[model samples]
Target: MTRVLRLAVSLALLLLAWEGLVLMTGVPHFILPAPHRIAAAFAARFDLLAAHAVITATEILLGLVLGVSAGGLLALTLTASRRVRGWLLPLVIASQAIPVFAIAPLLVLWLGYGLASKVAMAALIIFFPVTVALFEGLRRTDTGWIDLARTMTAGGNAAGWRVMLYLRLPAALPAFGAGLRVAAAVTPIGAVIGEWVGSSGGLGYLMLHANARMQVDLMFAALLVLAVMALALYLAVDRLLNRVLPWAADTTIPATSR
Candidate 1:
């Protein structure tokens, strides 16, 4: 498709510029390898990188599920009762204020240097956006729908459930999608930060190891793999959103979405 071609062209141009800059500056490969050298390094270490990729991806998946579930349930409680939101929502907001890096060591201290810490970091980064988006979605139900529910013997709890489940949820799908995109982008960063602080396996650990040993080629390759992994996760989330919310799949977003 034309869109795919354009993206390919854009990437090619970016790579070309990178290659040209390195050549013109006479930069050492150890300091900053050209694209070709980075590619060669990646190919040579493909198996090792693949293994680390699997670990990082697993952490992201498990964390995403945990964060979505907890955050969604919390948001539902807030929407169901004003008292709950008044008392409970501040804690949720406060949690995000704690720097993820600051908590990295604490997570390691509590969860050890395994997948647990990385998953915790990812969940922390992801939970707030999902909660906020779902909350807004529940609040955005149409007044006409509420009136019609009253007329149809679906008042009170029935009305709320019908709107929340059928209309508000579908309308909120796009925000949830947007929030997912933000969460996915941050997930890898969280995982890597965890690895930097304590983990034994993962691209982040591999990068630090390579750097400490002066294996610049291997480090560059790992860095490239990390970038690719983040992009891949983002794309996967986008595809899922489009698949589940086909109404949002169209090229032009409606004004009501604002």
Candidate 2:
């Protein structure tokens, strides 16, 4: 397929550049391992890498599910209640102002050096973007649609919840999907950072251990695996979003100026 070929070519070019840099600089193996050295390291330690990668992947997946569920519920509640929004929206906005990594240590300390901390970190990181995107989408629903819904339900005891479920939720799916894409892309950061701060397992933990032992090639191999995992997760989420909302997926403008 064309997409597969393009990806392969891009990877080859990057590997060539990396190999060139190593040869030109005469970097030591401990400092900058060549592509072949990294490949050997990956082949030698495949089992170790696979184990750690599974832990990190589980943490990321759990975090994403928790974060998306919480964010969607909060967005819906916020939309239905101006009073709740008044009380909660400022806090939500303020939370984003603080650097997430700054609180990594606290999360580790509170949750302990286990999967819980990493999952919490990822959920926290994903929470804001999804909530904000969906909330804005719900808020910005076309007034015409809302008015029509209101008129139809006027005779009945229709409440705000009914309006949101019947009208705003449908209108907000595209925005929600966009938020999910962003969430999926960044979800690994929280897990990896949590591992870096304090963890017994995962790729970040392995990278730290390898670096300390001067196993640069192994560290590079782990890094490559992490990148591949992140890319795969993002692509999977993108495909799911496309399948769920094909209209949103297709409603994109061409990059070139018209």
Model 2 backbone overlap count: 0
User: What digit string (tens of lDDT, one per residue) describes model 2 on residues 117-176?
Assistant: 999999999999999889999988877788889899898997877777777888789899
In order, the Cα lDDT scores of the candidates are 0.83, 0.92
After superposing all C-alphas onto the true structure, candidate 2 shows an RMSD in angstroms of: 3.1
TM-score of each: 0.89, 0.94
True lDDT of residue 183, candidate 1: 82
| C-alpha lDDT (0 to 100) for residue 162 of candidate 2 | 77
**Candidate 2 Cα outliers beyond 4 Å, as residue runs:** 250-258
Per-residue lDDT of model 1, residues 139-165, tens digit only: 866666666656776434455676567
Give the per-residue Cα lDDT of candidate 2 at 102.
Answer: 96
